[model samples]
Target: MNTPYKNAKLHDCRDAFTATLEALAGQNSDIVAVCNDSVGSSKLGNFREQFPERLINVGIAEQNMVGVGAGLANGGKIPFVCAAAPFLTGRALEQIKADVAYSQTNVKLVGISSGMAYGELGPTHHSIEDFAWIRALPNVPVIAPADRAETAAAIRWAAQYEGGCFLRLSRVGVPDLLPDDHVFELGKANMLRDGHDVTLIANGVLTHRAMIAAALLEARGISARVLNMASVRPIDEAAIIDAAHATGAIVTCEEHTIFGGLGSAVAEVVVDHAPVPMTRLGVPGVFAHTASANTLLDDFGMAPDAIAQSAEALIGRKG
Candidate 1:
């Protein structure tokens, strides 16, 4: 509720992610790191250094890497399968579905550099479709953390959780949105700021952007509430209902496509529980052009000003 983080310095969530994983690994001997030749990119260097034998690198073979992770889990080891999101979800999807999801393995699938984090490298590296692909599966719990604190908390949760889960993490630096001691609750949305005019919902890199959009709306004399809806699959439906009935207008933002990502998930809840005017902001149904991550976000009308404008327009439809 405090605004001390209004101008907070930015942090890359991967730092907190690996640090927490390492700390948990120290306590649980069964915890291990697995990767598809992405130890550095996945920020697992310290993990490899501390547990060299435990770091399994499959040399660019994502399918084999996921299979090995399943095998480790079957062998009673808690494997943290790490890789770039695009390849992890795209290349090894079948393996993930069969070995991890269908079998209900205890492998923690960590998708690093998710969404548009590799923005300059273009769409092939962009992981915009991961949420849709993974969330469609039966068993995996889909999650994306807003900042370093949430990333740490989610990692801790995954370590304790019994089945497979996808952790969507980005390399883009963001200011702290949650407290250091924040606890991760599965399928629960965190209300960052409260208001009455409209509600802005988002996760991952977009959560901070939503907060800024809420502030922009405030400056325009529109009271905006912000919700960090991190878990996409088992979404916080109760929060979505509260937002729809309380605010009457809702705006959902994400780093993924508007088709099947965070926005669509929230829309399903809003339409089912309480009909409300809504605006979904993200990459449209098109391949993103070459640019930096922030540039791509701005191009897709997800910048704070753009989100605020969308919310303002949607408020007109609230009846």
Candidate 2:
């Protein structure tokens, strides 16, 4: 496995998201979009042009946007609540918990420009804590799709899913790792590469990075397994357990904070079922500085080389 996707084309997941939503809207009259004045950032211009009346823009009001999404779902309309991730989850978390999750509404919460996608906007706009925030609620599935294919698949799944769910999407361009026909299933992890020395787990934009890291480890004669753990909440516990037992070491890399996110979720599973040597790479516990998403990620030691190094070190500690 020496980098099969070296020449893969880069794509913005937002394009796949909006395109998929527009297609779904054409078929389902009940499908609607609610936003917090984020039409451009959410890339809903075409959607608005096609279905003007269905696009509800609650100007700059995050709480009201969530409330309206819930109201629409109650009125037999499927609402995809689109907004910036920080405000969508942080400012209106109460509405998300009370109106959607607790009430069990069929609201599709699409957090656009999540993670450090807001790059230069600093920590105020960064949605690093979203996975932790939404995953703590009941009746909701938290997902961060890895590529364009996965993003479209997850959006299609959300449209049909009964209960409330959060779909965290990054604006950063990423290569298509999953196949076009890949179907997204809830709470399951996709094993991209298999090995026996160590396991590399990640999601969202970090999945491909993990693959690159696996290739780096392979070059150094270390067999590394790579897992795309997109479904964060009901994570693939079985996959995590198997990787732990098989590889004896685990390294989780995410665009989120080290606490209460992808790393924490994997660690929870490992500590519960099979204890293993692990390393969690992320923001570690601080507000990220003003920089591009990838720059901040590399600065925080999430680069492929850093990930490979962490995997090598963790493998050494596996007693």
Candidate 3:
């Protein structure tokens, strides 16, 4: 099985985001980067150097950072708010709701180092609850790109889109899960690998893991379909239901909590249309202890091998 590291050129999605944002900013002067003293972590140093005046740093106050982003958007500026995922989503949730979503502001909320990217920093730094928090908002579209290619595409699309949206960026390095030129489609799920035994759905860092799981399943004479579902809010219901009907079983994995993340989103579609046996792999439901991101994934049964085993178990339950 080809792992993420097997590819010669490995890239963190955050780099792609910053590069795309800077390039877009050159084309449109309205593009701006708003952060809470996270210029280095968010890879906005180049952006700041290029357009120092356009980079707005709010000095670690996540709430005020989000509010300022909203205000910037109201003033005809395309604000790309960048900060740690945990604080950006948890602390500034009210501003995100009232200033961005409720007010229909065209702000691009960029959550860097999201989904346990700062694993050694403990649960306080983890952003497992981001999916649930952002998905609940009415007008905001929650997106977690599967690879650097998808990340760049999503960034371009977000720049062109005229509405409030959240781009969940991770510092974790991921291999190319989608084609090099994959286009970003809102509310659409990309089918990566095709099979009939069981379906494996994932996004972000977990998408490559799901592909590895499918390879493991194939070795054991099991054919598993793989879906790279980047868009969490307007989920692809038709693709999900097709997988349920064809495979009869599904296994979903993500870097977020299983409660209201990708798994929960898939289960919602399955239970509504084509109910099937399924397994959701993620950070169970508890705050994660101090560990590296990969270690945390292994501890939570989301490692490639564990994901394969979970898919095998689900196949047994398939009718």
Candidate 4:
């Protein structure tokens, strides 16, 4: 299946995130926004203006911010902890494990500017390892919304869901992938296009690229299926197996490192159920040099053309 979504108007997922959050906060006073001096980045200024007291700015302390979120959850208040992805996962991994995951608190851990959205800032600011870090812990459903619609839907879902969850969002603009009435279903994959020759799976900013890659594959006389996989932790194993069995080959892409990100998660499911020729496209276990997000993606062979080429190669290995 090939769709012309790349040319659609782009949207920043954070806008949808804040708008949905503010609307939800209006109905539920228990909702709160917790951040580490990231009001501007997280787009929580409007949220702060609407509900000043409910917005908790912990200021520079990532660990303390997460701990505070856990405390708020304990006090019967729903806390949406927001911060840069690297600091959120790298700096507060212990607190996330002890106060949230282990305690099973009803806190929404929102990792803003995830993946290479902070591109050009340098590798230290990049959050390529967040998926690996957060997914290693149990009881936390890791998710990355593909577009603004999905972001808002996921935020709404997180508000209603109990316990803890990691909502990985990016500042990069993406065209609307899912429909406006799209409802988020955890552990379920959205089939953007149906094909039987091969499967192209991706999440976050890479999803649009995957769609474009599917189009490119179609131009070359290949039937490429496209899947937008948002939930990384509780991935759609059934869809993965079906794709593997039907397609006989797979190409997985992500904005995170290939070592333990979306590609790795899908590959795990494929090997266990229906082993097939697979190619994982991402930062191949190396700290990326300073460059724009799109440049880095192309450099790592995650650009649409590169992805399409890799899919063709993977399909060649199919027996």
- Please name the candidate that would achieve the greatest lDDT relative to the true structure: 2
How far is 52's C-alpha from truth in model 1 (Å)? 0.6
Show model 4 residue runs off by greater than 4 Å: 1-6
Summarize candidate 4's per-residue lDDT along 1-319 as a digit string, tens digits. 2247645788999999999999999999999999999999999999999999999998999999999999999999999999988999999999999999899999899999988888899788899999998899998999999999999999999999998999999998899889998999999999999999999999999999998998888999999999999999999999999999999999999998889888889989988899999999999999998889878898899878899999999988988
| Ten contiguous residues minimizing lDDT sum, candidate 4 | 1-10
Taking all chains together, each candidate's TM-score versus the true structure is 0.97, 0.98, 0.97, 0.98
Evaluate model 3: give its lDDT.
0.92
lDDT of each: 0.93, 0.94, 0.92, 0.93
Better of 2 and 3 by TM-score: 2
Model 1: weakest 10-residue lDDT segment is 1-10
Tell me the tens digit of each residue's lDDT in model 1 across 70-146.
99999999999999999999999999999999999998999999999999999999999998899899889999999
> Per-prediction count of colliding residue pairs?
0, 0, 0, 0
> Candidate 3 vs candidate 4: which has greater lDDT?
4
Which scores greater on TM-score, model 3 or model 4?
4
What TM-score does candidate 1 get on C-alpha atoms? 0.97
RMSD of candidates 1 onward, in order? 2.2, 1.6, 1.3, 1.6
Q: Judged by lDDT against the true structure, how good is candidate 1?
A: 0.93
Model 2 lDDT, residue 40, Cα = 98
lDDT tens digits, residues 1-319, model 2? Answer: 1254657778999999999999999999999999988999999999999999999999999999999999999999999999999999999999999999999999999999999998888999999999999999998899999999999999999999998999999998889889998899999999999999999999999999999999999999999999999999999999999999999999999999998999999999999999999999989899998789989998999888899999999888989
